[model samples]
Target chain A: MQTIDWIVLIGALLFIVIYGTWKTRNQNKSVKNYLKADDSNWFAIGLSVMATQASAITFLSTPGQAFHDGMSFVQFYFGQPIAIVIICLVFIPIYHRLNVYTAYEYLESRFDQKTRTLTACLFLIQRGLAAGITIFAPAIILSAVLGWPLVWLNIIIGVLVIIYTVSGGTKAVSVTQKQQMAVMMGGMAVAFTILIYALPKDINFSNAMSIAGAGGKLNVLDFSFDLENRYTFWSGIIGGTFLALSYFGTDQSQVQRYLSGKSLRESQLGLIMNGFLKVPMQFFILLVGVMVFVFYQFNASPLNFSPVATQAAYESEYADEYHKLEKELELNFEEKKLLAMEYGLASENERAGLKEQIVLADQKEGDLRNQGKEILKKANDKLEIKDRVEINDKDYVFIHFVLNHLPRGIIGLILAMALSAAMSSTASELNALSTTTTIDLYKRNVQDKSEDHYVKMSKWFTLLWGVMAILFASVADLFDNLIQLVNIIGSIFYGNVLGIFLLAFFVRFVRSNAVFIAALITQVVVIYGWWVDWMPYLWLNLFGAVLVIILASILQIFLSKDSN
Target chain B: MSPETNEKNGPKIELTWQKVFTWMLVANLIYVLIFYLIMKTFN
Candidate 1:
């Protein structure tokens, strides 16, 4: 990175921190102001929700996902709009009417105190672990790419978020997210434009589309009922809806985004905005990645996108084997490039023959890349620090593009954008964690506490969670599989919680005890399911919700029989 | 702030919500269609 890059990166980050802290600095820091600071317009709520959900991974890894796997990942969001509408219709009005700080608080009203506390603890366990990865996901990726130490990067992201978040609490999170969204989207848009212009002048957008089509990169929908497939249209709608419902309706991070709205209507409208725009936003990001794939098609791409992995491969005894694979990759890329250009220029009829040839060439390239990955893995066996090196290169592709391809200031801006995404989400998680802890646990158990005392405690708790998150991120490498566990942590708990909420909302007769016991059983079953690899982790959300609800109903009937 | 609408603010929230929801579902249908179109055109 050049001097201009450093200036842009540091300048943008500092501006967000100072702006967020400055903007909410004047709030009186009452409990409402500190934890549930309302008065966000719909647009602000929309952006906050979007920013909170889109961690650095969304920016860093999603394009890579598209680059390799194409746009079928967009199907993962098909359930989003449906989830949003359901939340607006049922979840928002009740939360508004009851005036709760966190989603778990509603359980106490509908069920008993134990159920609420149980759900709150489940949330703390899942989200607290996830908050660590919210920082570490980007830090590890950025550290590897930039050769920066991971500890410093983790602390930098965690502390930057803590500064503004602890300064003003919920309002600070909502306020800073607007600017964060702007930077993320603006940086992506500018990068996309530059990428398009970087393509060969003869290849117009239509011809570029043709090239992508020939490479089988433009696929957007898969309606198959294959349970083995993760992103088919059916799984996306049925399973995705369950997970999103758990996320938006029951998860406090997202729930808090709309809860900060100025009014019930504002909150509803805010969610509506998210429902409508989430898919298109994801589609646009995936489109940028497809363009990156196109960019690489014309340019010479490495056998592996991760430099450290490639370096390790070179350093190992397998350097000769790696070099041979690289040579083959070069030959294959040259052939694909020429074939791609011809396919781009080919007419409608000519494209079929060219597309078939290109697909075969693409398959050969993939086979070589697989061989390269095998060599990289074998090379990694010699590394002293095995966990830090990512053998798979999916997360590195987009950043690799930004670093080697983009001009100076924009690189910094894009890096800043990714870091800001990390900060934006971490701030929201800390804010929500602090709020749930203060309201659901502390205040609920220790009654008669003054709002001032609770508010003070909330601020301290935010700082505490933020520090823990940084600590987790710093030591993340110790647990080689921690990232994978954290990724599924939310879905594991989400199913039971969503079921409890759905019972509360719909099943009037299932009382607190039955629902509470059913939730506990469902949780144990869900954990066992995850342990056994019962199905894909995301489907656990659907399975858990259904299991808990059915168990609760059956228990309710049996308990009623006993009571009679 | 029209005077007639101002008087209806008490119950104003949900009158248009169902309509909005219906339209929103329609929009999702359109999204599916557009995605299908992309697949059909490109793949």
Candidate 2:
């Protein structure tokens, strides 16, 4: 980044922070206000909810996902719209009627205090770790791009979130989220347009899409019944629905968003809006990735997208061998690019002839790239690599492209967007984590306090969690797919949490001890099942929910019969 | 029936619009399931 870019980046971020603090200055100084924001309206609540879910990972990793894997990842969201509808119809009204602060608060009323605390603890653990990962995702990317120390990047990102979130609480998060969502969506649109325009002149939007299609990047749906397959139609609808329900309905990070709505109707509307728009929004984001993939096909792309890895390779004794491989890869890319252009212009029969050539070329390129990765890995092994030795995945591709290709001012804007996404998500997670801790544990178990005291504690808790997130972010290394790691974390706990909620709501005759014990057994079983690889992670949510309800009901009968 | 009883028993309709809408929503959801399955088969 140039001096101008640095100035623009810092200026944009400073303006956002100052603007958020000023807007939420008059937020009521009470626990209710700090945690729930007294039930706001459709626009504020809806946008804040969306912003919380749309993390920096969504922007940073999704385009890279598209660039490498193509659009099939979108199939995972096919069930989200329906899941939102389910939450709206069943989850919203019940939660609103209960008048609960945290989702676990109702668990106590429905079952026992033990059940409530257990569920709340589950959320705190899962979300606390997730908060760290969310911060880590963008911090690692920015560190790689700027050559900054990961520790400093983590602290800078974590502290900025802590400042506003600790001061303005939920209201501050909601207000700034509204602005952040606007900026994120607008930035994405601008980035997509630029990507399309940057493609070769003869390859218009349609031709670019055709190139992507030919490369198998446009396979958005897979109907295979195989249990091993991750993103199939069946898994997406069944498993994805359960995951979404667990996420939006039970998780405090999401439940807290809707719990702040002014009326039951407004909250329902906000959730419905999410259900309606989320899939299409995800589709648009993935489409941007597809275009980026197309952009690279016509242009020369690096053997490895991670600059850090490339730099390390250059420094190693394998420099000559790596340069030779790079030259060979470039030659292959030029060859494939010509074949693709010919296929694009040729008639049906001639195109068929060129198609095989293109496929052969693509395979050759893939083999060369894999070989390059092997060489890089070997070099790192020999050098006594201490950290950051993993092969960089497709997630960093889009960010690298932006940093290297985009112009000065626009580069800064994109960077600011990445920071905004990271902060928006981190703020919401910290805010929710604090709300769950303070409400579910501290206020309920530790001691009762005045509203003012609770409010003060909430702020303190937010700051503490923010620091914890920074610490976690500093130590964590980049995963092959950072976004999938986030989802996998959610999958581990969501089923068990959702199961506890399901037992509470529907199993009226089940007593507290039975349900609580069943929940404990169910959680252990779910985690064990995941560890042993009995089923894919997506199915874990359904397994957890069903196991709890079944076990709780049977336990209720047994315990009651025993008392007789 | 007495006058009070008659007044209390106003409109003994079997199904109201709200009930119909609820059923409609369920039917629509069922349709979505079928549509998804079909798309899976063909696409």
Candidate 3:
């Protein structure tokens, strides 16, 4: 990055930290103020909620996902609006009525301490692990593509979050998120505009989209009932709904965002805002990725986007074979470019003919790219690094565009956009993790503590979780994709927690013992199901929630009869 | 019995539960149509 880029990146980050700390410097003297920030308005709460969920992974890998697969992934959020509606009607009122610090505290009132503690522990495990992955997601990609040290990247992101979050607590997370969201959206808008202008003059937006459609990136919604498909319309609506309900309803990370609202009306309105805006915002981000895909069609792209894998291949004995694939790929790109130009001007019938040619050319290029990956894997196997480097190239696609194509100062702004997203999410996660730990675990176990004492403990716990997240990030490895990995982690545990909350709310007779045992059995079953790939990860949320509700109700009858 | 209207300020429901829900369903329908049109126009 040039001097201008550094100025933009550092300047944006420093502004967030100083602003967050400055805003909430004296407001957090009590547990309620530190943990809930009960004065937050609807807009701050809504932005914080959105910012918490849209991590660096969302900004970085989502476009790559759209580029490689298609826009079908947008269907993944089809359930979220319904989920938010359900939460507004059911979940939000309960938490607000109880005036609880964390979601689990209500479980204690309805069930027993065991059930509440059990659910809180589940959140701690899932969210604690997610906190690390959120930091690692952007750090690993930026480190790989920018040649920055991974450990330092992790530390820089983690420490920035820890400073503000530890200083001002929940209020810190809320206030800074508004600024971070501004930087994030501003940077993305700038990137999108520049990308459009960067495209070939003849290829207007419509033509560019046609090229993308011919390549199959515009298949936004698939109504297929196939269970094996992960992002079908049904799966997105049903499975995505359950996931969103569990996440926003039961999970303290999201619940805490709105729990800070100045009034019940404000909190509900904030969530409603999220429900209204989340899908379109995601669609816009995915469109940016689709546009990047269109940009690459006219330009030369790497055979594989992963820099480390390609570097390893270049240094190994397979270098000659890799170069051969590169030459073949270049020739293939030239052919496809010509075919695309023909496609741009063709009539309806003629366009169909050109699309077939374009798809065929695209398939051949994909085959060559796969062949290149195989060679790179073989090359890496010979190296001392082994599996330390990722061979899959999807995560690297968007960052590759940013570094290679975006202008100097804008590159820094985009990088700031990425780091801002990282900080916003990690701060929320760390803040949530610490809040749950203090209220549900520490304060519950060690009673009669002063308000000041608990506030101090909250800060210390935030620091500890921040350190743990950084440590986990430093050692974290890439899975299929960073975004999916975080969701999969949430899916594994979220369904069970959501189930417990559902039983507490809707089924009044299901007592603590039955629900607790049912949750244990369901967790084991869900983990086993995920292990064997029972369904796509999204459905796990539905599966776990349904299982717990069913098992708990049945167990409640048996246990109640026994007690009588 | 609706959770949304069970408030002391309950009788003055500004955005009624029914209306808000209808809006959600309607918005979703519009989004689906727009997405389908984008697909048809390009493909």
Candidate 4:
């Protein structure tokens, strides 16, 4: 990175940290003010909600996902708008009625303390782990790409979040997120514009779309009934809706974002803003990825995008095999470039013949890339990398492009955008984690504590969770696939909690014991199912949610019958 | 409910928010239509 890039990146980050701490340090004299921030406007809430959800992984891996897979991922968010509308109608008013600090507090109101505490503990476990991964995910990637030390990257990101979040609590989180959101979107927009300008002279935006579409990168929606297919319209609208409901409605991280609003109307409007904007925001990011895909078609791209993996492969026994594949890929790139030019310049009738050749070349290229990936995998096994990272080349695609192609200062802005995403999400996670710890667990148990005392405790809890997340991030590399493991852990617990909330909201007949017992059983069954490979992991969310509701109702009926 | 969440934000619902949602949903549907067209056009 150049001097200008450093200035842009550091300048953006420092502004967020300092501004957040400066603004909210004095406003948090009471528990409500510190944890609730009852004066936040809709715009702040909206931006904060969006920022919390868009972790660094979303910014980094998504474009890479599009580069390899196409635009089918956008379908995953199709249910979100509908999800937002539903939350506004059902979840918002109820949360307001209870006037609770944590989402778990609502569970305590409708059910019993056991159920509430159980659910809060589940959140602490899942989100506590996720907060760590949120920092670790980006730090690892940035460290790999920039050749910076991984531990320092983790500490820097974690500490930046801890400063504001610990200083100002929930209000601090909301305050900084607005600036973070601005930096993220502004940086992305600038990157997208510059990317378009960098494409070949022959390719306008129209022709680029044609190229991308023909490459199977623009298959936006599939209305298929195939259960095996991941990103179909049905799965997104059905599965995505439920997921969003659990996330935006019940998860305190999101609920807290909107709950800080000045009024019920402000909160509802903020979530509605997210609903309207979230899908398009994802579409834009994926489009940026698709554009990167288009750029690679005209330029030379490496067989494997991960520099570490490629370097490892070169040093290992597979070095000869890797180089041979690269030679073949280079030759194929030359051939495909010529074919693309012909297809672009050809008359209508001549285009069909050129397209067939282009398709054949594209297939050969894919085959060769697969061969490269296989070699990288084989090389990984033999390498002495104690913290052996998997060689998923797709994850490195866009960052690789930015480092190689984007102008120096713009590069800094984009990195700033990514780390800003990291800090934004970590801040929210830390804030919410601390709030749940304080209000749901600590305050509920402790009687007659002063408001000032709890406020002080909230700050301490924020600092505690922040330190834990950083510690987890530091040792995260010691275990392989901790990221995927964390995601799976989240899925296991999320469904049961969502189920508990659903029963609370909808099923009046089910009381505390039924829910408490049913929740314990459902968790055991869900984890056992995952262990036994009973179904796909994604289904666990629906399965666990549905199971708890069914079991709780059945248990409730049985209890009432016995009483009679 | 606290006065913070009472009649102030009740009854007199913002017509603009309702309209805004409908408009946003309409725009979303339009986005789907445009995306489908692009797929077909370039396919």
Off by over 4 Å in 3: A347-349, A381-388, A477-489, A525-540, B1-13
TM-score of chain B of each: 0.57, 0.54, 0.61, 0.54
- Candidate 3 structure quality by residue, lDDT tens digits, A1-564: 999999999999999999899888996779988888888777888999999999888899898999889899989999998988888878888888899989999999999999999999999999998899889888989998889998999999999999999999999999999999998899889988988898887878888889989999999989989977889999889878877888899888898999998778778878888988888999989999999988888899999998988887888898999999999999999999899877876777889888989999999998999999899778767756525457888888989999999999999999999999999989989999999999999999999979999999999999999999999887765343455677787888988999899899999999999999999999999999999998988779889999999999999999999999
Q: Considering chain A alone, report the TM-score of candidate 2 relative to the true chain A.
A: 0.94
Cα lDDT tens digits, model 3, B1-43, are: 2434554431334555786688888888888999999999998
Model 1: per-residue Cα lDDT at residue A302: 92
Candidate 3 clashing pairs, residues 3+ apart or interchain? none
Candidate-wise lDDT, in order:
0.88, 0.79, 0.88, 0.88
Candidate 4 iRMSD, 1 decimal: 4.5
Highest-scoring model, DockQ: 3
True contacts kept of 2: 0.00
* lDDT string, candidate 4, A327-428, tens digits: 999999998887776666666678677777877888898899899888878877765667355678777898999999999788889899999999999998
Using lDDT as the yardstick, the better of models 3 and 4 is 3
Instruction: List candidate 2 segments past 4 Å from native.
Output: A316-318, A346-350, A380-385, A446-448, A477-490, A527-540, B1-43
In candidate 4, the residue pairs with backbone N, CA or C atoms under 3 Å apart (3 or more residues apart, or in different chains) clash, namely none
In candidate 4 chain A, where is summed lDDT lowest over 10 consecutive residues?
Answer: A381-390
Residues A1-564, model 1: lDDT tens digits: 999999999999999999999999966458898888888877889899999999999999999999998999999998888888788878898999899899999998899999999999999999999999999999989998999999999999999999999999999999899999999999999999999999987887778877777778888888888987878888888777877888899889999999998778778878888888988899999999999998988999999999988888888899999999999999999998988888887789888888888999889989998998988777666666644367889999999999999998999999999999999999999999999999999988888878778878988999999999999888887887678888688778888888999999999999999999999999999999999999888778778899999999999999999999
Query: Candidate 2 residues A317-422, lDDT tens each?
Result: 8889999999999999889888778766665656566767776887788788788888888887786435435475576788888887788878877888888899
TM-score for candidate 4: 0.96
